[model samples]
Target: MMLRGALVPGMIALPALAAAFWAYAGEHAALSALAGAATVFVILVVGLLGITAVVLGPAATSMAGAGVVYLGQLILIVTVVLVLRGVDWLDGRAFALSAIAQTLLMQVGQVVGYVRARHEIHPGSLDRGAAS
Candidate 1:
């Protein structure tokens, strides 16, 4: 039940993300607003996944979830860069570096958020399951 609830946001966001990406790609000139919206949606998905992994059982899923999240982020970055480059909106070199930087930042943020949530929920002991 808890795991299902935790996954709800990511599940919902996935479709919205697809729609946003489609819309962006369909446009002759993608709007910065659209890019920002897509980025926000991705962030939300990452946050939800990170939180879900943390809350359910950090030790059990943290590494795996983080790896998956990181990979997804890399894919997203590549997709975004390809789209932007195809549209001539961003230079390839700059976009590539930006993508790498963004992934690192996101990973750090996820770790911090997970640690905070873990402590908040279980004060001292870290052995308790998230369902507790």
Candidate 2:
């Protein structure tokens, strides 16, 4: 589910951001932006979804273990971002813009996905009992 939600936003943001960067900047910038966006998206989805699986699976039997997993994922993400920042091939402006855009879009997609899911599971005031 997390992957599904993230995929929608990633698909929406990547091409749009790539096109914008290409028009305003150049091929390198566009490519860098797309790469950065993809990296961020993968990090987010994998970290969250992976932890979710662990939590739901037999590996994480307690909330404390889940918390530890979450912390580990955060550290891994930060490490990746820091490493990416030092890379010579990265375009700082495009990378920053793409990261921000993709993150925001992911948040929006998650909210929409949650609402749609909630409505599907149980029709409330917002859903109005409408058919999914």
TM-score of each: 0.40, 0.71
| True-vs-predicted CA distance for residue 92, candidate 1, Å | 1.1
Which tens-of-lDDT digit does each residue in 1-132 have in candidate 2?
A: 555776787887888898899999999899878976777677667766766677677754757766777687568757767888888878988987898788778877766666666534444655565555
Best by TM-score: 2
What does candidate 1's lDDT look like per residue over 102-131, in tens digits? 334444554555555554445645656544
- For candidate 1, report its TM-score: 0.40
Whole-model lDDT values for every prediction: 0.49, 0.76
Q: Which candidate gets the maximum lDDT versus the true structure?
A: 2
Candidate 1 clashing pairs, residues 3+ apart or interchain:
none
lDDT of 1: 0.49
lDDT (0-100) at residue 18 of candidate 1? 39
Q: What is the lDDT of candidate 2?
A: 0.76
